[model samples]
Target chain A: MLTGWGRTSPTAATLCAVHDEADVVDAVGAATPERGILARGLGRSYGDSAQDAGGIVLDMTTMSGFTRDGSTLRAQAGASLDDVLRAIVPEGYFVPVTPGTRFVTVGGATAADIHGKNHHVEGSFGAHVRRMRVVTGTGEVVECAPGSDAFAATVGGMGLTGVITEAQVDLLPIATSRMRVDTERHADLDALMAAMTQGDHQYRYSVAWVDSLSPAGRGVLTRGDHASLADLPAGTDDPLAYDPRPRLGAPPWMPSGALNRASTRAFNEAWFRRAPRERRGEITSIPAFFHPLDGVRHWNRVYGPRGFLQYQFVVPDDASALVGLALQRLREAGAPSFLTVLKRFGPGHDAPLSFPMQGWTLAADIPARIPALRDVLDALDGEVIAAGGRHYLAKDSRMSAQTLSAGYPQLARWRAMRDALDPRGVFASDQARRLGLTLGSAP
Target chain B: MINAVGQAQSVLVLGGGSEIAGAILRALPAARLQRVVLAGRRSSVMEERAAELRGRGIADVETVDFDARDTASHGAIIDAAFDAGDIDIVLLAFGVLGDQEALESDPAAAVDLVTANYVGAVSVGLHVARRLRQQGHGRLVVLSSVAGDRARRANYIYGSSKAGLDAFAQGLGDALAGSGASVLVVRPGFVRTTMTQGMSEAPFATDADAVAAIVVAALAKGRETVYAPAVLRPVMAAIKALPRGVFRRLPG
Candidate 1:
């Protein structure tokens, strides 16, 4: 399997097309006598974290079954976030802490312990998870819940914990389908951070979009929160049930040249300007707010013939300066990203490789062909490490194994848990090997 | 951006189901080859080849739709493979051997042969070359032939096609200088494969396995050019060193 987007081109490979859950279980059963079994979700992960380079890859996203318990939802590993959101949101409950897209699976979310715009208020999804079912390397099926070592080990464990066949996620109680968002514009970087810190507290949910293409020292920040039921105006009351007008996709295999620097820069300007200037109290749906980007099926194709590399880094609150510094370096290096998002992270949960903490996380997507791109990112990795921060494993495509080890100090403990559960090293992945997240060689 | 440093990597065989490509992949270090991809016209064959590679310790095997004659999509095809993961190397071994009599009878068929053997490869080579340049490192191993050194009426159609390929590969190697990437040109005379099922063989002709060994060795050294059977090198040198009249009279 080639890299997702963010690179200039695709790589080739020989692969197994596992169509269903039985394929996953069988693949797990056939692994070489060692290691734990971590299931693979969609290949959206930039790095090899989701890929089993030389091991059995249990592609369980194909599993089809779902049972809802009031606000608590239980779906198979193959069930996608979009599937859950669509199935449950209309019933008056919403999944907590969705990432940028909804194509990700429930199993993937637990494995990566994904977080989102509401992270500052709700923490990560791992925190809301009630329980998980995993298949061990020895072919034993086990169950775990929050506070259990297995629970902590499984969530954000990057699939190293076990193959999450099904997960119980705590959904939020919703008043309506639309979110009454109040987006405020920030003239500068400091103003943006100021808006995020103060405004996030007032709203149950929050997110911001920055003009990453802005001059090194200047940028725009758009902040928002969930709309209150009272915010609805003269329109009919049931905005939740109102299906959004869908847009058609590009015909077929569109060229990468469509998403050039000029177009992206222009889009950024319009998005920053038209962010409902002054929080006009517009009624927006859940998909628009949570998974605004999910509309474009293979949006990565926009990057063109050159795929892109996504770099997401979190710097502990102590090193806020590094955020601005890193952007400046990008400008100076002429390596600007097409999209950059900034979010506030609450206290991190238990996953060793999970990417969250009480700090600011900024994510950017850049085409892979840019000269010196790797060097610039490598240097940035050092800065984040110096600040006691680390990179997000899900969005990482090029981090070295050494960097992974150095960034995640608790890796040994995680490894110990993984080994205890899967001594022979049954569960393995290309991402784990590439970044040294798995048990390496013999040791 | 991929740091292949200590991790096992992947290799792509452009010609799916090519006996030669399969042979080469089998001989490479199993630990280093995490995955293998066979790109060709029929996915069925690509699948068969992928299985073969996977059996040789390449647990990750894949097949992509690729048509040599359809050169328009070469860039996307090669780039797509690299994007899947880090394609450590790309082995371009897709080619055809048309009958000299058919080529002599029909110029149209000869042109198709020319496009398949040279034009299609040139397009893919250039497209893959740009990617290799961008990734900062990769390998491009193309299969050429001794016939390319000097064209003869005996097989001018195939000889000229190789002539074009050989030149292109050499130039690509030079273009990649200092880019941390290079092209390895393989000039193997005759290999008993589907392409030459009924060919007449001369002395020093080797099989796919023998060609695989020489090509792999040549690659490990980052050599500019190589000849199968080792003796072919000296033999070709002496041939090129011969008088023009004598060279043309010799069997191609």
Candidate 2:
């Protein structure tokens, strides 16, 4: 919920609908844009990452526009990750680093400059963005390349400079959607990180699902990458083109129906044990491997009416000591995340405004009510910043702007470029205003 | 033919409550759509529209206050949006369709109508133009109407107001030609909505949903001028090019 331009409402803004990028763009252009606008995705971000409270917001998902040239893929701002995979994987290419799900738009990916499990090895999605076609505050549609300062600024700028209409994204060659995954149970947080660090180079993507319920440091470490054709059984056809449509239906958001102590525990136990012991071979479609959770759409609604908050934070490796501390806080507060992801992060990009850095990033989707969730997150945000790390603008829905300032050290520099490019500040979101992430206060 | 795959885009309708614009947001697929913020005078109304979007998976929905007549804060409004992130499209969809009878009954109401529809829009439009021109790219979709084609005694005030807006948008569109930015003028017939409660339906009168479909098409094509009824483009031409004295004698 958004009150006045930057004001917040007690109720949360829920994603109850799907939109086309073209329509969203038209709607924004629908008006004369007397005040300008910003694009939002998922509403998963807490502050204003996706909201320009008082102004117009270019809902790009309507663009649902897509095309492919050689290995390069392009899509309208509104195209979601699921949309992208559905279109290309059958043709043998895969999106770089899809987050836990495939419901996000490409524009949101670029604006927030999101990163995923493979961040330590592949960097942020911005790294793979070859060129972006943007609609500025003034209504000019300009093209920005990776080398362009504007692109660098806008990529991680979180839609502060202009709206990204479409982009020429570099795609990767994929043999199949199936991933040859390896799962190992870790005793605590340290073992998980050690496992991730050692296993990162061995795969294109790696992730760990932490058992936030276990005492301080316990969790499950999962690692995988697209298995090369050589790793698959000798087939007579192009295995990459193997279209894996859903055989059985996944449950919808059942309002606390799918997630609970018994169900979550069972699912986690099954997930950890069922992973094939023989990492030697597996065959599946792109959707099954890269975006398994995507099979169940509107999963957020599963958190029930109370809603959910995704508190994602990154801290330097030295901050590992804080892992047990964090777990203690979450447990003491009796806050358990329904879904938690842990990954080892590498040094952040020189974009002057990127989110990932040389550290570890953990993201958790917890019910809105954990008594100490807010305070715990605040403390984590503090520790992460003290360790020279930052939080992801995409998944965050809670961290204070001050913590954000401390986390993203380049906030000031990025804001300068944002102001220089858009001095009028025509593109502000609810998160930015709440965190006071304006030009003056940036890093 | 408009290549839509992988092309992520965002569109923010300032007055998302506008039936014409809201219809447009509805036509787009929810997956590709990013955020739809409906900024208007009524928070409840805006919230309702945002809820409609969320129902469609366009979850990044928001609502904020924006008085079309509020001139002093236009820059802050624009700056606020810019700071949120980058903006690709800005739709200045705020206006008043005041009743002609009411305007005549209270002359002050007439002033409010003009200020909200024409004067206020112009002030905000100028701010939008300058900012978009500076950013170097974007599109401004302005809602002009078939009434803007030619003013008649039936609704001269609202018609003339639209006429002024039509002219402004055309000029703005021209000014941004090579700047990678453009303007789209929407001219639709008497739409069947709350705005036309008392008036008899006109030829080819469409619902908000239909109007939105045409607008989406126009935006994708980046068309300079869009006639809502589609047939209105040609029909309005003959009406506007009509001899004024003769035209006035037969109407109303």
Q: lDDT scores for all predictions?
A: 0.72, 0.67
Q: Write the per-residue lDDT of candidate 1 for residues B1-252, one digit (tens) a residue.
A: 233221226788788778888888776644445677788878566677776676776668878888877988888988788766656678999888888888899999999989988999999998888777655456789999988987777888999999999999999899887654678999988788877787787678789999998876666444779888778888888877999888767764
Q: Which candidate number has the best lDDT? A: 1
DockQ of each: 0.05, 0.01
Model 2 per-residue lDDT tens digits across residues A1-443: 32211111221222222254344345444333333466765444433366443355554555667888879988877678777787787788888767666777788888777887788888888889988887665546678897777888888777777777788899988876567767677766777777777777787667777777777466766667787777676773766564534444434434533455566657656665665433433445556656666566455556554455666677788776655666666656666564777787766766766777777777766665333455566667777677766777765555555677777777777777776666555666545554556637323
Task: Name the 10 consecutive residues with the lowest summed lDDT in model 2 chain B.
Answer: B1-10
Name the top DockQ candidate: 1
List ranges where model 1 is wrong by over 4 Å.
A5-25, A33-38, A216-222, A234-237, A242-246, A251-258, A440-443, B1-252
Residue-wise lDDT of candidate 1 within A153-183, one digit each (tens)?
7888887756777778888877677777666
